[model samples]
Target: MSGGCAVTLDDLTVALRALRLLAVDFPHLPAPDVDVSPVFPEWLRLSLHDTSCESLSAFEQWRTALRIAPEAVDSRTQSGGRTRVLKAEGQFAGAVIVLTAYADEPAADRAPAGQAGGVR
Candidate 1:
């Protein structure tokens, strides 16, 4: 739906597959934990942006939603890690997706360690 040109799910899928290939070949990409979109090497990010940019917002929403329902997540018996489903109900067409991304720190957004009462 960009500039009156409809971008479809299939187009996004192809772009993702290419990005996956790049990730497999490239190493040490920054975790996709920056704000909403996963951080990647700039070149890779630009490449993905060029590919069906219409759906990026939908992807972010799904990622955030999964994080919300922690209890519903399945962690494969692992400690401190649980997998969740992305319903894709709103914008991603009829795809029920499970996203695989770097896990967030147990308290990444909380107060720094060893500090109390707003004092260092």
Candidate 2:
């Protein structure tokens, strides 16, 4: 919140939308599922499948250890995948982690040179 510019709820919404698009467009990596609470002030929940649970958990722990206003919890899946949940209250204005799934091949491999890569 005290990073730079004061972010409004609307800004968070826009960021969430962008994150969703990235997830849908790139699912092989860390595709994040974002859920925004419809309450006043605004609250955001992000879920993603991380191959490295320890790393994600460490990140969640670091957030709290640093005394960050927001709180984050990292959970593990039965399949050994990791999920992270972050919550912020009162017009939460801050950065949201968007995990992008990495592909073995470059996006360009699936697309003609100079063309954008996307599912057809």
Q: Which one is best on lDDT?
A: 2
Error of 2 at 83 (Å): 9.1
Report the lDDT tens digits of candidate 2 across residue range 5-113: 5656564564466455545654544324556543422334444334444435543443443344442332222211222223322222343432212212323334454
Please give the lDDT score for candidate 1. Answer: 0.32
**Tens digit of per-residue lDDT, candidate 1, span 99-119:** 333222234433444543121
Clashing pairs in 2: 29-101, 29-102, 30-101
Give the C-alpha lDDT of model 2. 0.38
lDDT of each: 0.32, 0.38
TM-score of each: 0.22, 0.26
